[model samples]
Target chain A: MGKTYALTGNPNSGKTTIFNELTGATQYVGNWSGVTVEKKEGTIKNSDIQVVDLPGIYSMSSNSLDEVIALNYITKDKPDGIINVVSASNLQRNLYLTLQLLEMKVPVTLILNMMDEVKRRKINIDHLKLAQILSLRIIPTGADDRKELKNIKDTLTLDEVSNFNRFSYFSEDVQKAINELAQKLRETEHRLENDIHWLALKILEHDREIIERIKIINLGAVELGYKLRDEIQKQTKMELPEILAKQRYDYLREISEQVIEDLDKSLVTETVTDKIDKVLTHRILAIPLFLTIMLMVYYVTITGLGDKTIAFMEWLVGDVITKTVIAGLNTVGASEMVVSLVVDGIIGGVGAVVVFVPQIMILFFFIAILEDSGYMARIAFVMDKIFKKFGLSGKSVIPMLVGSGCSVPGIMATRTLENERDRKLTIILTPFISCGAKLPVYLLFAAAFFPSNSHIIVFSLYLLGILVAILSGVILSKLRYRGEDSDFILELPPYRIPRLKNVAIRMWDKAKDFLSKAGTVIFAASVILWFAQSFDFSFSRVVEPSDSMLASFGKLIAPVFSPLGFGDWITSVAFITGFAAKEIVISTLSVLHGVSEGALVTSLQNIYSPLSAYSFMAFILLASPCFAAISVMKRELNSWRETGFAVLYQTSVAYLISMLIYQVGSLII
Target chain B: MTIVDLKPGQSGQILELNLSTKIKNKLLELGLTPGASVMFVRTAPLGDPINIKVRGFNLGIRREIAQGITLK
Candidate 1:
């Protein structure tokens, strides 16, 4: 088998940057089969060995999903060696994770990244001295600098051996206990000496997985661990794990003192970050700043540049593609039925969804910038206080923000939250946030019927989502388990100039995901919709049907929405199609109404009045997210029950809100 | 005194924890053991969940929990 190596580190450690540089064009990025967690694997440019870039995590303790994924891969997959990437500037805390990995006895080569950052901060690290003390080869590298790849590649050739011995910073009594356990492991008949010792230490640390594994190997190991724990507690008067952790930190501090030199005490970047945070995280300024930024983003994407791009694409599809296809069908002497199905159903339906790609890309562009520049983290920090009042953490803000991009990623991002209750609540409420996919539907209706006040209408729809999400969270917290008290702990990565390459890559990745879905799920749905609309159950001849199946279904459900003002069968069917993907709603409308050549604005006005249009926007904003989002929620929450609850809750909220809007508006108008 | 009483930039060593049993357990899980040195990072304008640097990471603790953590 070819040798495998893994890149593991804490968040914001430039681990991904290093991987991208090493693998270059060889990398493949996709989801981890059924899970929403991203899986990245690639081979070294000039080597046969494959490298897997695990998710960024603080430690291998499995407190969070990233940790679980990282730890599971390292321990179970048993890579030939592991590259323990550490940020040289943040050596003290980074070393904590390194020490944990060392205890696992994996053949680890330390890659000290961000050497340039350390130099800029006036910190000097004696790499040779550090390597000697840790008993591992260390390579100091600046991930952004291509020159450091050669040094990293050279160190990768080192023998897969761990020479380090475990050191405990605990009291002498606890150390004696560990030493005894270590001696027992050495004396065992097991051929794997390193694995045995590592397993024993993990047992001492109360690692559930290790304990379970030991039970399967030898029940006697459990008795030995119990005795060790009892003896250590009796002698040290402290918890076994805490004692070990303290001891490790003590040793780390000593090593840090010797090998690290700090020439400057002031962290200039931190000062700047804090100054920015003061305004960004300020209670009064925060919401307004957030609103203003979002407004600018929406204006640029939905009404400004993005709208223009989308309009052009729509024109190309509706005017050019549809006309060409129709002309071809006519020249071939094709039946009118086949021509309408080909031109109106397939082309029009798919065209509606594809036209919204520009808006989605522009929205993701701003989101990527916000996330990469570390402003998204601050948004969480500032919003945490408000979310806390509703029994949620600051981290919950990420899901909500992501929901604005697409509920699928928003629901997936909930994995970062540690609290199960918080995760569930966040997932369920995420659909309330107006996703980018829903923008076309909103813009379509808003621009047509509520032209002059379209901006305000769109803004209100987004605001309504926030209100509903918060209200649902509050209600759920009060009703559900009251035991989980939410708390927030987040690392504030020092703000740097957003790298254009990284931003572009992120934007491209997100846009690619949208396009891939459009090509597959939306494309298939469009074709199927075309087939359904073309054929009908008639007498004997099987001639062209008067009304398609979709039209019939729309008529069936249209009455239920009559209270909401736009009870038109075509409009109802459009809403139903949105369940597949929000952009498909517009496509369905265009196909159903036979408006083969018109802007979404013009097409929407033919179907909805001003009051009904506003109500439709409200409904789409709060409706159950696309099928992909529901599936993601199922995966992240790991419970069909929770996913079902999310869909049910969203649909109910959408119904109630839309009803209220339609009723109130009709009475006033 | 509890962390809630500490001004911004004030540093202190944790002396005692007076939180409810459940909250205490949660705090312990997050590596906030007694005797850890902490520095006040900042407070929100409304003064809830005061930010503090502890155990080499930033943590935001609510006023209720902050009231429980006595600092020396």
Candidate 2:
């Protein structure tokens, strides 16, 4: 028979790493707790056992979202067994969760991750003694070491998971109180899946979730439980929860005294972590250093190294692939119409967005390094101060940065944030940052209107995006999402040489997502645009694109954007098509005007001056995101109502800002 | 005095937490208890969240949280 087990651990304890190593399921393991905000399941490799990996939690308490989610899964789902992953160096705190798990009567096997790090620190742990003291089986293992990983796999058997022993850690009077409470609860004609002792303890601690549960089953139990806790609280100088915590720690300290041998720290004066933090997180130097780094990342990932590769891709696909396809089709005696559909609709349209894949992948590569190397969290810490002034937190920074690459993954990255309101606000504002696909639109306008200052014009557009995002964040917080994620906390994991395998896997995953999107969405959009411009209504060929079906449709919506200064049917059509995918906007323009890609620049110059052109660029920067990003936003946000609000709000903001820029600039000039 | 009274590199035992139940519970869950020694490691660049070292590991928490935590 197949068995099912769950993996639970504190954040940054390498729980997901063990899950990947053991199950061969490559889930994205971020440096912090956000990526795996939801539970994921995969079958253990070469075994019948199924392993469910839940989000990391510091405790089973339901105050925070992660805790509530993880706690609910364990209580409601009741997996047959649990593998408790703990950072060996931080065993005291990690084990606190283990004790909670044990009280719930789930069979647990402790996997001591980061054992290698402990060894490097020269600290020694007697695992056998610790295991015996806690009445839980402990397996000392490291995430990277083959031998240690093997030890974990060897213990994944049915018998091993069910091998833990039961022990009590509460003080005498507290234990007596818990016993009486459990006895009283058992007397009630109600059934509960959890061990009665755990329920009694949680109730005594006034866990709101469990108290609500008690109110349903036996309302009297709530009063009784609180009465017992009040007596316990009155006797202790410490608070009610701390009374329990003290007892647990007292027992834990005794266990650690026997199990952990202190190492001579004088041998290694100050850790490299300290030396690095002194500089990287320095009070005065941090923000300047961070700005310099962000500029470097922008230059290297988007323009310097990234642009060279993008240029190569554009050349290879546009010149070489088009030439080869035309030659092959000509030999096969393909019709001119068919050839036009194949070359212009398919290759020209999709290839525009496809060339951006390299740039997106480069951004992902850099983000992966920062994430895997542990700098992402530090950046959050450094930026949290400034961000809070805007009613957001530092955690919103990653999603915004990732938004520049692509908004789909950018919305997905908001899972790293723990607060509901903050996540929603970030999702609403992330798409405003100019993505790689929108780069084509900006480049086109800048080149046509302001050739000499195109670079500066584009740079200022990027800044405007950031400015608007922050301002919108402030307004949203003050109006709708009120408080910050005041439980603003993050564990500063020791920095290591980021494992290359993890970074590569993350990059490959992002690349595949980008490529798949480019293949399907852009391909379909291109064919539709081509057909719209090539044929008139009733499916007849039109010599002039102005007489085609798309032109009529563009004329209808053209007036809506008239106030923004670029209101012609052609511009309207381009705007409408750009919604399908931003990169296709330029391609749509080239097709509508019946000009070569190179000559489309001068043709666009004939349409609009620099003033209106800048307004159009501003609109594109803040408008509703593409369909792919919209779907991701829906998934990440709480409700359809929120998603609709986000979409409508973005488009409205875009329209107002564009109109403001155009009207103001027209008056000034 | 509150934890903010401690300078960087200063270590003290936690005395009390004058905070909301949720935030205080979270702090206790993260293993900060009365009498547990914690070092005020350093302030971040923007000087909002203060980093602390406890149980041989580091954590960054908001300064408002730090101000509510009494230590000696």
Best by DockQ: 2
Q: Which ten residues in a row have the lowest lDDT in candidate 2 chain A?
A: A28-37
After TM-score superposition, the amount by which residue A565's alpha carbon in candidate 1 deviates from its true location, in angstroms, is 3.1
Top candidate by lDDT: 2
Residue A609 CA displacement from its true place in model 2, Å: 3.3
TM-scores of the models, in the given order? Answer: 0.91, 0.89
What is each model's TM-score for chain A?
Answer: 0.92, 0.88
Put down candidate 1 lDDT per residue, A339-380, tens digits, no spaces. Answer: 776677677777777787777877878887788777877777
- Candidate 2 C-alpha error for residue B46, in Å: 3.6
Put down candidate 2 lDDT per residue, A88-148, tens digits, no spaces.
8777888888888877877788888888888777778889888777677777887556465
